[model samples]
Target: MKEVIATHSLDEVGKHPDFGSAQATLRWMLIYMVEETAGHVGDLDTRREVLDSEKG
Candidate 1:
């Protein structure tokens, strides 16, 4: 999916529906995914550190 997105042209992006264009939709989705994933990772890391500290 990433490779397919990288190769998509401006014209192809413009053809996307539901968000004015494919690029706009793709850009927002990527931003949202990254932020959400980062938050989850941070939360998991914090929990792991706390658990390890308690065990030590």
Candidate 2:
């Protein structure tokens, strides 16, 4: 993925039919990837807190 991104401009557009009909540029994809990763991390952290509290 990094290599592909490196070869293209940030303005380069592509389709993500699996996600939706709307097309997104490389910049948008990168931003979405970061946001999704952060959201998942937050979810895991919340789950960890719940489990730790239950252990008490």
Candidate 3:
């Protein structure tokens, strides 16, 4: 991801045919990736907390 970012401009646009012809810039893609990853991490942390409490 870092390499791709370094090679392309942030304003570079790409087609997301799999997503019904949607288009997004490199900046938007990066922001989406970060947000999605953070959400997943938060979900995992919550699950862990629940399991740990049950164990105690």
Best of the candidates, lDDT: 2
For residue 39, what is the lDDT in candidate 2? 100
Question: Per-residue CA lDDT of candidate 2, range 1-56, in tens?
Answer: 98989899998888775867677899998999999999999888889889887422
Residue range 13-38, candidate 1, lDDT tens digits: 33445656335455666667889999
Pitting candidate 2 against candidate 3, the one with the higher TM-score is 3
Ordering by lDDT: 2, 3, 1
TM-score for each model: 0.58, 0.76, 0.78
Q: Which stretches of candidate 2 lie over 4 Å from their true place?
A: 15-21, 54-56
Q: Where in model 1 is the C-alpha error above 4 Å?
A: 7-24, 54-56
RMSD of 2: 3.9
Lowest lDDT 10-mer window, candidate 1? 9-18
The count of backbone overlaps in candidate 1 is 0
Task: Predict model 3's lDDT versus the native.
Answer: 0.86
Question: Which ten residues in a row are the worst by lDDT in model 2?
Answer: 47-56
Q: How displaced is residue 19 in candidate 2, in Å?
A: 9.3
